[model samples]
Target: MAEHAGAQKGDVICFGHTHKPWHREVEGIHFVNTGSVGRPKDGDWRAGYVILEMSGDQPRVEFVRVEYDLQQVMEAIRQSELPDDFAEYLATGGIPRPVESAADAE
Candidate 1:
């Protein structure tokens, strides 16, 4: 993500691409990631976002996960033309088929 889009020196940079969430300050600017709302991939069941605020001299970051109906997502998946296994994934949170290891080839 592009941080400091026309931002000044004292601006905060927040972005989320990697499923893992993090917050830190480099030099003077604060860098943060809001994390993932779906398929956190961190093995945490919570789906959420992050909220940041400057409290005095330090920046405060909070991650919030709201309860959502997975059934609705599942139903949408079922109704859509997506593969059936997608709904299966939603229902069971099971990992999809694993790719063959290089050792298996040799």
Candidate 2:
């Protein structure tokens, strides 16, 4: 996909929306996925971000993860009238647990 982005050599393209963090270089074009800062779907509950440093014609990229009070966020969602599944998604890092039916328990 980076090749189709019309990036030339030594060009860096940073984007994030999928909530999955990733970085790669294709044909001298640097592609970076900055990940998510709040609702991360990369199997990591922590906040994800990136740091880009450019010095003297060189560019550096750094991926950062931060931990916060997930319980508090989940509690807020639980109290708001949002579906419980939302909290579950945050707790599980986008992997939703299968809801067990009462009959299945028996």
Reference-based TM-score of each model: 0.61, 0.80
The per-residue C-alpha lDDT of model 1 at residue 72 equals 86
Single out the weakest 10-residue window by summed lDDT for candidate 1. 1-10
lDDT of 1 by residue, 1-106 (tens): 2355335466578887886678777666778888777756454545778988888888899988766787888788889999866666644434454679999879
- CA lDDT of each prediction against the hidden true structure: 0.70, 0.83
Model 1, C-alpha of 22: deviation from truth (Å): 1.9
Worst 10 residues of 2 by lDDT: 1-10
Give the local distance difference test score of model 1.
0.70
Query: What lDDT tens digits, residue by residue, belong to model 2 across residues 6-105?
Result: 6454477888888988888766667888988877887898877899987765579889998999999999999998998788889988866788999989
Best TM-score among the predictions, by candidate number: 2
Pairs clashing within candidate 2: none
